[model samples]
Structure formats: C-alpha cells, structure tokens
Target: MGRVGVDGEQRLLLRRAEELVERAERSGRAVSRHFYTPAEQELIAGAFRGRTPLTLEFDGGYEGAERRMLLLYEQGEIRPEPPLTAVAIEFPARAAVPAHRDYLGSLMGLNLKRETIGDILACPQSPGIVFAADAVCGVLYEELREIGRTPVTARPARLEEIVVPEPDGILKRATVASLRLDSVAAEGFGLSRTRMAALIAAGGLQLNFRPCESPSREVGEGDVFSVRGRGRVVLTHVGGNSKKGRTFVELTCFLR
Candidate 1:
C-alpha cells in the first residue's frame, strides 16, 4: 500500500476502530482487536471520544508499555481485554541482541505487521514480546528463528510472571505558562518560544503523533506529543492556575 499522509492515516485508523466497535456491539462478543502504535491508540481513543456505550482499553502486558494493543467491545461483552499471549524468546548468554530492531525484524520476516506485536522488552537474559494471540502467538511460538545476532526459541509465558528491565525513558514534571502546545513544550524542553514556534512552523512537531504546525493549539492533559530532534513528552496532568493566573501543567518527557 502507498504511504498515506498523517490526516489520511488518522481518518483510516479511526474508521477501522469504529468498525471494530460496531462489530463488537453487533456480535455481542469481545472478539474485536487491533494493534496500535502509541499515537494510533490516542487517535482510536479520540474516535470514541467521550462517554459512550463502547469499552476501549489498552495494555502492553506490564506497566509503562510503549507500543500498546487496543481492545474494543460493547458495555457488557465478554471483556475488553485483547487476546494477548506473552512469548519469551530465549537466547544464549553473551549473545548481543538489539531488542527492538532484531526481534521486530524477525517478526516482520514472518510477514507480520508491527501492530501484531506489542512491547518488545529487551532483557539481558531474554527478551519478551506481547503478541496478539489471535494472529501471531501460535505462528511465532512455532516458527521464529533468530533475533539479531542471537539464535532464538520461543515459548508461552505470562506477562505478570516475567521480570524485565524498565523501559529506556525518563519522566520530568514542569509548570508552564499555559497549555498552548508550543509554550509548554518550550518550557519543558528548555527552548525559547521563538525557537519552538519556528519548529512548529517548520512541521517539526507532532501533537499526539499527527503533524501539528499550529503552535497555539491547546494541549489537553494526557496527550502525548513529540517535537522532531527534541524527543516526546506526555502531558500527565493539567492542574489549577498558577499564582500569576498561568496554567499549571505536569508533563513527562521521554528521553530519546
């Protein structure tokens, strides 16, 4: 398929998400599922945007999972949890493994889309992958060959049972003048408003993973945004106004 622009991709993903929601409602089963990038997950949530009869949930097996899988269902279906299977791929010790790239490449070599898999936790002992059970669990458990420079073998496991290293990221809290995206981003990242405006105007920033050139756009709490060459941050909370009437926002910027 040809590359779709950000707007096109967002529309397409929203449509698919709604379709899944409708299917789940009609079938009365929690049988609908889709893999979503962090940004796509945000888009999907926006598709259902307010209080509705739909149930949408996300999980990547453990806390602070980056690439999450989205599960959709009606209010009282089986459950909103996607059918996930944890596959721990064991490799020889002393084998250098590029967690994300290597395991992802091997899975793609199996003709799997990146969405079919969730977080690929790279542990020194072994790396684990959370895969959508309906499509990839059996195939990978039966067929994965190698990951990067390490010979690998897979087996079924429980996510809660595994102890993996924390994700490679950091969290920081900052108080900004307002929720205007560029302004908060500027403060959190230690850039001047002029520089931030320049970046936004140059199409070097993304609001919730979609291209956003407007610096004055209002960023709500819980929105994850990125600035090219600077890294990504999540607006963890929107607090009350500051002493001088400025908006108080708390955000965590993930280190690149």
Candidate 2:
C-alpha cells in the first residue's frame, strides 16, 4: 500500500514535498511542511526514495508520535526547529473526561485543516495536550474554550511541558495455522476470523500503518495491525511450530 497508486491527495502532498526539497536545495537552508499522518509520510518517502540527495527529517511535538512534520535540509545547513506548539486543555476535576475525538472535533470546528494538528493526548483527570502547528496557537488559546459542552481552559504551553503516558499493553501468546493478516489480527484483537476478514475488506485494518484490504497478506514478526474504533496490536515474536503444526506467536495488544 506504500505509494502503489497516486491519488489526488497523495499527488498533491508529493508535489509539496518536491517543492520543499527544491527550495531547500536552492536556498541552502532547511524547509518543512505541516504535520502529516504516517500513511502520508510513507507515501512521501516512497516517492522521494533515492530521487533526491537532500536529507529528510521528521518530528512530531514529542517522540513516538503518529503524525509528524517533514524537514528537508542539506548536509551542512542549520536545521530549524519544527514549527510545533502544545496547547493544554484543562478540564475541571469533576467534569467527565473528554474522549480524544471530542478534542479533535472541537479543533476542527474552528475551520482548521487536519494537517495543521498533530496528536491529541487525553490524560485522565489531567490537562489534555494537543500538538498543533505554531501558527494556530493563538487561535487555539483564544477561542478553544469548550469541548462537546464541557468547559475547558486552553493555553499554549512549551513542548517540554507535555507529558505522555506510557502505553498500556497486554501480552498474549497464541498459536495460529498461519501468519496471515486475518489470523494474527483476529487472535490479537479477540475477534473472530470471519469478523476480522470482513473488517479488512471494509478498509478497517491497517498493516504497518498502511490501510490493507487483503486478509491473506502475510504478516511478519514486527508488523503492526491497527483497527479504528478498536486498538492496535503488534506481532512481537514468531516462534517454532507447535506439536499440532500451528505457528507460535506473541502479540502486544493495546486496547482503547
């Protein structure tokens, strides 16, 4: 699924990437674009593979972020900081905790492009932090006063102030007939094989951060499977076959 077909959005993003690279090369300086999802970033990477000598760097406001901005620079140019800022939305202690989608929805209501926003970390009983482009920090600070009827105080904060919680994952070991995407994903996500296959066919599954519609796709040890509305699972290890001729596998499941 990595740049297999150039859709309109992918083509536009690729063109922007090329323009940024050309600008960086011409001016002998670093240039960057707004945030991009992992899929978009992969597309950009595939399009530029071995095609340009410029160095490419990606960074979100924090480490282990799914959405990040791309930086293009030369070998000796001084790399500029990523134009990212953190907006902390503090909910009242007694207020019901807002879901991630709630925060994102409120932001979108402000007429902001999705690309300008990064990750929204919803911390329980604590201030939720949103990583957005620096250009929108003022608007977010000024107008973002509520999320889905719950009043919240939004303020711009330094990136260092963001505190991301550790991922909570449950480790499970299982044996499957094969390492097909459906087989491993069903076991890891506690779903029936039929249901998993249907989910894949409906474009609800992502193999290694790219939407995959093939349930029979061979999955490897390091492959990650993500299902929207469910959670993410990583195929951590592949071991020897069992006595019943089933392949042994370990997975780390992160439930939403």
Local distance difference test, candidate 1: 0.72
Give a tens-digit lDDT track for model 1, residues 9-71. 677777676677777667764433445787787666765757457667777766677667666
List model 2 lDDT by residue over 1-256, tens digit each: 2355578777778888888878878976554647998888877787776887887878897889989999877778788688988888988999989999898999999999998999999888658899999888888888988987889988876565688989899999999989999999999999999999999999999988888999999999889999988889999999999999999999999978
Q: Give the per-residue Cα lDDT of candidate 2 at 64.
A: 91
Clashing pairs in 2: none
RMSD of candidate 2 to the truth, in angstroms, is 2.8
Among all candidates shown, the one with the greatest lDDT: 2
Displacement of residue 142 (Cα, Å) in model 1 is: 3.0
